[model samples]
Target: MNRVVRAAATVILLAILVPLLVLSSAAVGPAPRHWSGVSLSGWELPLVDARPRQEPGTVRAPHLDAVTDRLIARGDGGWQAVVPLHDGSVYVETTRLDPSLFAELGRDFGGDRVSVVYAPLAPQVSPDGGGGVPAQTLWQRTDPLVTWATLMFGFPWQLGAALLLTAVAYVVAARARRRRAAGTAAVPAG
Candidate 1:
């Protein structure tokens, strides 16, 4: 094969393989466990009541056993939660807490009752909860698949820059080719 064809083929192959590698690696570990009908203590209120939309909330275990950072979201008529573990792993869960449910529960019970389904992503750091290493924020630790997708599809600026560079290169090449042809035509036949 020609050099350009070989280079293009290599680029295409890498583009396909890179995402597959990232996704498959993300699925390597044990699946995350799910819990249902998790009861919330009134003291746990600080943990669950705060809205993830505004900012992250902090929760210390009722017995002061451990500290956890929590993020809660209630939008699109649904609810979601994210908690990062000490080992740089993350737990993501979602619940369907519609407005009607809230109205039925009223203000008192609304914050106490919930059903959660959670999964643990790969740990980015070792499991050393006792170590002095500070806990990582939700932003620092995220699922690999989510990270990969964001890098692949979310940045419009990168695509725009690439297109601009390609256009400039094409124009420069065209001008060079024209100059070469004109020079050759002006010379007398040997």
Candidate 2:
């Protein structure tokens, strides 16, 4: 499309996507308190099953081997992972807690109403990753925001990157046009 068309489309699309951005960001980041981390150094002992300080809903998703996978699947359903990070910390990350479990907290869809449960698996460190924390996922909470962001805003943010690039292109074109006009005005017909 032409410059004006592309620019107009960019504005319209971004406007439509604003709320979506808020949602997905909420999904992956901090909106949900579902992700719980423990001090890896302090709990130096071997761990058994997930020792959840908090309890999640009965319905839960399966555990993925990696954080990235867990994050991607979080919104569809709750999940748990014990990531032993390189920083000597065992990050027990879990998501998609059933809101019903914490009804007193708020409604299932309410911003403050979700929960994730987790506990350290002893001997948290994988035998091989010697020095660094093995990146274990103890537990995580589901924030409406994270859930929304993951489910909604995620795709927009991905598109946002492309939209941003187009915007830059428009700006560059505008500048180039201005320079060309200025050059024309300065040149007396040779």
Error of 1 at 155 (Å): 1.0
Runs of candidate 1 exceeding 4 Å displacement:
1-149
Query: By summed lDDT, which 10 consecutive residues of candidate 1 come out lowest?
Result: 34-43
Best by TM-score: 1
Estimate, for each residue in 1-190, the C-alpha lDDT of model 1 and write its tens digit: 6759856864555455444332232244222111121211111122333212112454422411121121212212122334443333323342222223233323322222332221223233322332544555444444444434432332233334444655576689779989999999999999
- Report the C-alpha lDDT of model 2 over 51-90, residue by residue, as the tens digit: 2232333323232133334333333223344433332222
How many residue pairs clash in each candidate at the backbone level?
1, 39
TM-score result, candidate 1: 0.30
Overall local distance difference test of candidate 1:
0.34
lDDT of each: 0.34, 0.38
Q: Which pairs of residues collide in model 1?
A: 52-72
